[model samples]
Each structure stands twice: as C-alpha cells, then as structure tokens.
Target: MPKWPDDDVILFDGVCIFCSRWVRFIAKRDTAKRFRFTPIQSDYGARLARTFGIDPNDPDTNAVVHRGEAFLQSDAALTVLSHLPGWSWTRALLAVPKPLRNAVYGLIARNRYRIFGKYDACFVPDADLRARVIE
Candidate 1:
C-alpha cells in the first residue's frame, strides 16, 4: 500500500471549480500550515482515494486523511474546518446528525459540476500555494 503523510491531507477534485475554491480557502485560512492537499487526479491522490473506498474516477465526496484515518463527506469538511483557526466551531455541525449532514453534502457534491462548473484541466495552485500541494 502507498504510505500517507504524517500531516493532515485533503484530497479534492481538482477539476471542480467549487472544490478548487475550497482548497484555496483552506490554504489561506490555515495560518498554522497544518494541512496539505492532493488533487484526486494525481497518482498519489488516486491511491489514497481507493484506499479509503472513494472512487477516484467519479468521486462523489472529498476526503481528509488525518492521523492514519480517513474522513469522508461532511465529516471530512468539518474535520478540515476544525483545524483552521477560529473555525473550530464548525465541529458543532456534528451535533446536527451525520445522515442529515451527509445528505446535504451529497446534494452539493453530486451537483457540484452543474452548479459550480468544472475546469477542462485540473486546477494548478499559484506559486504561493504550491508548496502545500502533494503531487
């Protein structure tokens, strides 16, 4: 099996506009530099996705790999947010119930392309943000 990094890593859809934008948002707010990123299109990302049981070809949800465990759907989003400064409050959403949270996440994820659009090519981070990307 492929080895994962020691730090938290977010695996996202690089061609999805919404997913790309979310990555930038997290990169900006993560002042502590606690997170790294991987685009699902990359070899490493694909391996990680498969290990977590997420389809790399037609991903319906993003994922977060932290402390050797994978968090999918709403749990993944909240886990990322919880690590951002002042964003720990997002964990409260956990109290709303997982099925409900995942339902909402699934809605957005399934429609993400039609609703937010897609890129003909995978997104490439700007120079400043490139350092945190794990190809």
Candidate 2:
C-alpha cells in the first residue's frame, strides 16, 4: 500500500512512443499543473500497476491515480482529459460505454509497439519536464 500522490498521477509505458507522446500532450494542455507522471518502468509505477492487477512487464493499459482512486485503460484516459483545461469535453466519450471504450483502448495498447514503434530505452524527460515526473 504505497501512498498515492496528492495530485493526479498518470502511469504510462515509458518505452512506447505513443504513450510518451500522450504524456507530452497532457503536459502541454495541463497549465494548471494538476497532473503528475510516472513511467511503468519505474519502481513506484510498477508497484502501482501491480496493485491494480496490471502486469508491469507487459502492460496493456495506462492508469491514472486521481484523488486516491485508480482508473485503467479508457477510463484512465478520460479521467486525465477531464482534468485538463478545455479538454473536459473529451469526457463525452465516456457515454460511448465502458466495454466499447476499453475494447478500443485494448486494441491500441496491443498494437502500440507495432504501430507507433518503441524506444530503445525509457524516455528521459528533460529538466523542465522532469519536474512533473514522480520517481
């Protein structure tokens, strides 16, 4: 039972180009600085993933830990969007149905490496971006 962060924390596949890009997208839109990030390759992120029953070594979904609650897959994406300024409208996707949303998320997650390619190593954010990353 590791203590979750006070702010919203996103756990993503560090080696996935698409996932890293999504993190950058959220960071750019999150002017309020309400979100923090952790790559699943990190120790803390791995523990969190395991707690949620997500395999860290072969993760098929991203996660968002917001206000002590953890959201997985499509729910996690929607949750992150809702917190971003001007991005709350994306929450409308929630009406699409959880199973459908998760199915789509799963498809993307399963093919992410093949479709978007992977980094040889986990992304290492620069000093400026590192401020928002939770080790």
Candidate 3:
C-alpha cells in the first residue's frame, strides 16, 4: 500500500525510451486533468517508488497510485485506461486476466530499452508540464 494519493500519480522510468513516449502520450489525453507523472529517477519519483517497494535506480515498468495502493505493470496500464475517457470500455474488458496480462507486459518491459530505445538521462519536465508533476 501507499500513502493516500489526492490525485492519480504515475511512477515511471524517466530515462526509458518507451516510458518517455507514454508520458507524452498520456499528457496529450489528459483532457479531464486527472493524472500526474514523475520519473522513477527523480527525487520525487524515487521517494514514492520506495514507499511501494520499487527500486528507483531500476524499475520494471510504470506504476500507478490511487487511494493508498500502488498498481504495477499491466494493472497500472488498465487503471490508466479506465480513467482516461477514450479507453474506459477497453479497460473493463482487459481486466479479465491478470496473469496473462502481466506476462505480455513483462515481455515488453524486459525488452523495452532495446526495442524502444533509451535516454542517457531522465526526462526533464518542461515549463508547461511542470505543474502536472508533484514535487
């Protein structure tokens, strides 16, 4: 479990090639203004990840926090889908099989940097997106 989150929080790898793309993608779909993001390498992200038993130096994939619990990998993806307007219905359908969902997610996470490319340093939030970050 995690501390109660006042809003949706995404904990991700800032330097990962695939993670960066997802951050940008989610930012674009945040019309309802319900989510926030931070890189696991950042101080804020590190603190949060540790609270949930995640390694800051190296993380498997994205983590989503709501209430006081942290959801990882495919479950995190499903949570995000359920919250975002366009994908809510699909989120419901995807919830049927957790093990299978994570197996696929894990495969991608294991090969992410190689397939998706990586950044030398964690991403830095721009002025416009800074407000969407906590700490």
- lDDT (tens digit, per residue) of candidate 3 on 29-66: 87877889888887888988888888887788789886
Rank ordering of all candidates by TM-score, starting from the highest: 1, 2, 3
Candidate 1: lDDT over CA atoms? 0.91
TM-score per prediction, in order, is 0.95, 0.94, 0.90
Question: Residue-wise lDDT of candidate 1 within 1-135, one digit each (tens)?
Answer: 344555599999999999999999999999988889999999988988998888999999999988878889999999999989999899898899999999999999999999999999899899978999888
lDDT of 2 by residue, 7-117 (tens): 498999999999999999999899988888999999988988898888999999999988888888999999999888888899899999899999989999999999999
Q: Please count the clashing residue pairs in each candidate, in the order shown.
A: 0, 0, 1
Best candidate according to lDDT: 1
Maximum-TM-score candidate? 1
Could you tell which candidate, 1 or 3, scores higher by lDDT? 1
> Cα RMSD (Å) between model 2 and the true structure?
1.8
Ten contiguous residues minimizing lDDT sum, candidate 3:
1-10
Q: Estimate the TM-score for candidate 1.
A: 0.95
How accurate locally is residue 87 in candidate 1, as Cα lDDT from 0 to 100?
94
